[model samples]
Target: MATVGDQLLNPESGWQRIDDANKNIIYNGNWISATGDPNTYAGTAHYFTLSGATTNSIEFYFYGTKLRIIDMYWSNRVNNVTVELDGVISSYNPNNSTNKYRVIVFERLNLQYGFHKVKLTTTSTSNNFSLDAIDIDSNGEITAPPLSKFLISSEDKHYSITNEYKDNAIPAMTSNTSPNGIVDASSFYTTFYPWKAFDRIIDPNGWVTNINVLTGWLSYEFDSPKTISAYSVQAGTTPVGRSPKNWTFEGWNGVSWIVLDNKSNQSAFAGSEYRLYTFDNKVAYKKYRINVTANQGAGDFLAIGDLGMYELDKYISSVDTSEVSFIKHGMDKGMVIDLEDEFIERRSVVKENSPLGLGKVFKQKIDTVKTPIKKASIT
Candidate 1:
């Protein structure tokens, strides 16, 4: 049969031992073996004493979500011991009349994930303090999934301009065109030709098609397929019949243009706010095309200020919550102590080293008890 000490030291058994002999496990005084009798200890010998002074203490560092303190219990000459977890102090009194060995003195579970420190100090010198071992729950490390990339239409660099309103001073269907057509050139009524609706600009002075074109379209291409859930389009200065009224949003899934959203009879007021649209189902594609079939007014012209697309936000659905119980020694609960100063940040640096062209990840503090929200999703 495996001895109690054997079980406490076994990694497979989910118990980690911190004893007097460990160099990292601080001990302020001399080590002494138990004497004077009918011992209740479970190992080679019963109780062993590690002499403690009023100021004597043992401190150690650990990384986990839960911690448990184990110590030897004797009724005869035991004194009160103080325990601190991450600087929060709680006292334990091992003054029971019965002679119990290898008892749990204190335990704290469900702590935030990260590195932690624990300290045990003797408050009274009348009797010596006995520390047999300290056992920690084995499963405490956090395993986070790889971070994802944030996708937005602004990041795209390629597009296919269909009906560009060309001007002698300004380029036609170029990304440089302001989505709102608000550039300096737009101040002149005759020269106020904006680039094209697909140029990603919202400048009020930007492009607009000649009044009365039966049908028109603009296509955008990205380096990789992206998942889009919502889109918005700003109307140009001419919000009358020149604005698009009926249109279809399509995506190229490497095969054909798949219709994502079909809007009809849409209205746009000249110099009014942008019109926004959301898709019921999200789809992934490398190319997106907007086909305008009808204009708001009888005129065939179509005016678009700017256009944009965005992906949905992601979140963690679940996390691991396995529990590991600690073997009781003599650690007590409910002894009040003053709270220590809160931990302060020593420095700030990038959380991860991502690929040169890929996006980066930022560090954030989170509550383990609540579900965490993530801005992006992995492809």
Candidate 2:
């Protein structure tokens, strides 16, 4: 009777699992991303290959002493996986009569603590091969060549919008809308302002455009330039058809708006569904915008529950310690303008200090405000 942690299959502790979606792994083949298997998988997603002729393989560069390869074990899945670590090869057969998800098909331990490459290849891919996730030593990390250009989200100083819908003729702050935070949008419906999308709320009340305003945009301006590589959009409550179907994520130079990513004819979203889109963006930009052109057959308006931008992972193996030190030195010298002062002047500020170690203390400050910029209708 082999238990979950028996036979050194799955580690019971001291292991960190990295999802298949992590950019560190290089997948070679037409690997399809899928979910909703009969049994739950790691991160509820897996990448499966369809081609039997092609040399389907996946390579993970890691710095660790132990590793575990997780995959799907199911009936009719006839494939032989060969895992090559530092030129040493080992084989495993995941084909089983019973269905199981997140099965540790391969495990290796007590390796030299240094950089290593693990290449998993399907030698006899009579059917298909599925990769769920990989587990590594708790102290080790996925090590790869550092990316020169990536995008990241930093605190911005300003936001703007173009239009907003109001139910009554009076112009005053409502209980539903915040009067503080810098946000701007091209258009919005009653009580649903652009800042609502950035408020970190997952409720029904979100940013909505005026009726029939198909083409609109929401822009943000940062105090300094930032490299952003990914963005996410969360669906609002009910009538998901109102979500943006066609849109261009753009960054603004001094002269023009450069399209970073363009999506069209997107499927309708489910309520509060969060979707992430990643693209290659190396250059830093001071301004960014989401210009939407169409909705998912919602003839009345466009709505979004939330939106967010992200930067590349600043992993220790991927980041230069000297560069981080230089940035910190510049900040300590006041070479980079601190937006905290201006932010605190306009809103409530909270500060805290905690002791880190003997004769060492850490300080943190938080500023909260809600303010919006100019708005204009796009007819």
Candidate 3:
């Protein structure tokens, strides 16, 4: 959308003007540096970020009066940074004055797509931290006039589609029918998009394999609480590798698991750990999922996990709108920033261009702020 006041007044080509006053990407930039400098906390400021190129979202606004949201920090990729705002994206600390003017907003931090380097650090050492403008909103990923043609699908083990399809996208893969795997509501897959919902009737003993899986089924039904108090199966393990991940709400409520979580065995490879599920509350079974596909056998760490149902008052609607968060940003399509809306703005002032009529050519100028005749008790 690229227009939030021209991306908050366009500045951050990758922002790295760390005028080191001593340990101050955080709090000391409040005052102090005219010449009596003293803000050094290992000063090695940074910048340079191609990394996932911004569709992950970043917003900006800064005024600076008392400015002290715990000094400052939107820091990136290391430990990431989220002082415990609990929205879960990364790196945010609003515990001082809540940064009224020194406005600092944070957003989803799903990196690891391409080049990586992002920096806005500070321990706040006081160089009089002055930065009033900065904006970088990227969905960046379309390089050149390259791909004229690139076909795929095979004839060996499973798939073989060929003609990779793309002529403005055949009205979303079909004009009157086939949506490929389905995603209606006019958002015709809006470039392959789908909200989380899959049901295999709650992974019986566990299963996934429908020839690599495109997608299907998603059901819901509940009501057995007049006699059942607990049952669990809260799986949400995106563990990270690829393909739909998030759904770790394991089951079993005869005793433990007010929520019970498990990453589900996602092939297990790199740093693999949490994958578990033991809480079988005698199997109350209703419905649940998270088997994106692929189980021909043997290790599979590509990653994916979803399937949750915790009933009470519907148990907060079964806590899991499918926590799906993503943004490829290249093939097009995006706009999602809601972890308390970590600063995302769009729109650029383009509505004042309607005055061109020698003889009423496409006209629409009526209201002149004239609404006065309300003569009921006025006489």
Candidate lDDT (C-alpha), each: 0.49, 0.62, 0.25
Model with the higher lDDT, candidate 2 or 3: 2
The most accurate candidate by TM-score is: 2
Q: Candidate 1: misplaced stretches above 4 Å?
A: 1-195, 198-200, 204-207, 298-300, 316-379
Which sections of candidate 3 miss by over 4 Å?
A: 1-207, 218-242, 245-306, 311-379
Ranking according to TM-score, highest score first? 2, 1, 3
**lDDT, residue 302, model 1:** 62
lDDT of 2 by residue, 1-379 (tens): 1222223334445577877777888888777777665454444554564545557788888876677877767775656778899889888888876577777777775564555778888666477677777888676787553222121112432121111112211112222233432467898887788777777777774788887786688766655687776777888887788788899999889999999999886655767867666676767887778899987777788888877777653211111223332222111111112221111112211233232222222333333344432321211
Better of 2 and 3 by TM-score: 2
Model 2 C-alpha lDDT versus the unseen true structure: 0.62
Compose the digit string of candidate 3's lDDT tens values, residues 279-312.
3232453333232333213243222222223322
Worst 10 residues of 3 by lDDT: 314-323
Residue 32, model 2: Cα distance from true site in angstroms: 23
TM-score of 1: 0.33
Task: Give per-residue CA lDDT, model 1, range 227-262, as digits (tens).
Answer: 665666666654445566788988778777789999
